[model samples]
Target: MKNFALFLVVCFLWSCNKDDQVETYTYTLGIPETMTKVEWRSQVAVQAPKPIASVGKIYAYQNYIFINEKHKGVHVIDNSDPTAPQVVSYINIPGNEDISIKNDFLYADNAIDLVVFDISNINLIHEVERLEDVFNYYSDYQMPAEVQAADYSNFDADSQVIVGWRVEERTEIVNYNESFFSDNSLATNTVGTGGSLARFQIVNDFLYTVGSFELKTFDISNLSQPNLVNTNTAGWNIETMFHADGFLYLGGSNGMFINSIANPAAPEYVSMFTHWDGCDPVVVDGDYAYLTLRGGNACGQELSTLEVIDISDKSNPTLVAQHALDSPYGLGFKGNDLFVCDGASGLKIYDKTNPLDLQLLHVFSDVQATDVIPLEDRLLMISDAALYQYNYDDQNNIVLLSTFNLN
Candidate 1:
């Protein structure tokens, strides 16, 4: 009888413990695809300056600065006074990704088309010409909700372009694992320099743009109308392009390729310096090429590093020095100072007078910087939420000139 009573007590305690435990469940919402591209060529209209949100590449020309608003448009900001910049106007171009200025013309990519705009008067910006169906293969838009997978079957290149995305909610259980993550020329009127993250660059009269696996060239000898000259096979996962002297440096996920642009219209491959798979952006100074490789997402690795390569001989480039970094993104140089955008670690400035031993000068930890442009008189740093301008002195001291927030 005593053994039976003890067994009953143990059973009762187990039942009580089971009842005390709470059950947890995850609920997900289904998001259906709703965004479609309209005929933006006919819908081009100048809107008043709106709030800045998704910022991409930035280009400065004369006293005006053009900031890309992701796929929406370009925001024109007058920075005549570095201390206080003003948003003069906004040019609405659907599916716009990058911008470059030469003389009075602004070149931008709109979905599959290369659109040229007359930016002589920021308020009166108008599309001068559209070269249709240039970039046909690009990543598609992804929905935010967790339930349904993106369906691109309806996306027809002949009639439509994936310009943007829209979200609609429905209650459903989504599989947790499946997730999809996805311009310009100028002349005699000098072409404005772009950030290291830029993929579109203008060399003399030819406009070069690097896609994932090809380099498309356009003869922009005529500013208003750009002609498609040729498309050459670049390499796998080409992320950015930098032009110097008579050569083109193509930064790919797998390697750095140097091409001789002796024939600006047809770039010939000279050499390739291979590296581990990662997203890389490169900038060249003198005989050295500096590349920052950060691994994450589609980059196929988890290593972050800054590599200094000796390109004294373009055909036989050699890696001279390397330094590990904390998720470095875009980098640029001014004089002997190199600025690296170290993702969440902010902006890291290094004195690269000695490329073998790059000395850390300063780290601005306030913002999550992604790219930088070291111009003649000031420094422009781009973060996820803001654009920062700073002035550097001989003592290596950097003073904040102004900040334009895109919240």
Candidate 2:
């Protein structure tokens, strides 16, 4: 009886093992693409202001607010009355993300080209000039399961620029045993300040923009005609750029780089403060730099913290203090008060008069904040679905001004 029971147990184990060893297969999928050309230029026209559907970056110029519509265009709004801000015009720019204004001229990226527009007359805005192929990085597309297992030999880089993407269903066979991993500035004049999430900045007469691996410089000395002067290879995953004094502070996934813009057209590397890999945005005040590093998603690090670095000495930046945060994103400053958008935790206001002992003053926990731009007494906060404006009192109390919905 004991031998019969042992044989039955062995048979059961074999059957279970066989069931778990079923053959696995991989398949190729198709992905849809929106392609454009490097020479493509669109005439700036005044379209009936459309409701905000997507929010990318927000910029304030005088009483006007310019909000980016991701890869679409800029929505010009008259914010003279914060209580009743109205959308004035929509500047149709394809593959657009960032915008900066100087001396009535608006600078924005239209795919591979840097297109400048005359916003002095908002109703009759027109494209003045386009610097072709200044920006080379294109938006990535989703790869279908079928395309993932197939060759990208059909991708044509010569004539078309991929602007949008969608995945389609298809099939191909492949061995499923292996695992796969994928990884992925400006001006001066009366230029409006972008959020800490900005990649474009205008400092003096030069416009600086940081790409995934390079910093492209353009001479905005001639407002209508921006001349591409120099391109410097920055580190990988360069995310945001900020100008303080004569320095260009760059926040990358891996570190914070300080470049001297003493020569506005030619930036020289000053120093770099390294940290764990993550998506980061930086803002500076006085002698200290506030950097927020967030984890999860494609950022690659599991850390969520705010780092304060002393930059009195530009050549060497030292980490002065560190504070653990909850998924912090873009940040900005109003005087000594630091406004941090802590994702789901909402907007956190910190008094950084003393960088070493940072104090939290307030937090609007109800809002899902991602980035902030503090303009004078008003604060502009961007979430996934809305653009919010606020007015702060002398005692640091915030008053809700208005909200523009982006569904």
Best by lDDT: 2
Q: Write the per-residue lDDT of candidate 1 for residues 1-407, one digit (tens) a residue.
A: 11110000000111112343432233222222323345546665567888778878778898988888877788888889988888888888776777878888989887567889998877788889989878853433322323222334444545555554553342332222432111011011111111222278998798898876788899999999999998988877688899888989999888999999898888999999999988889999989999999976457578899999999999999999998888988899998899999999999999999987899899898889988888888898888788899998652668999988866
Error of 1 at 269 (Å): 1.5
lDDT of each: 0.75, 0.75
lDDT of 2: 0.75
Backbone steric clashes in candidate 1, count: 0
lDDT of 1 at 360: 87
Listing every candidate in turn, what is its Cα RMSD in Å to the true structure after a full C-alpha superposition?
13.6, 11.4
Error of 1 at 26 (Å): 18
The C-alpha stretches of model 2 lying farther than 4 A from their native spots are 1-40, 43-45, 139-152, 166-198
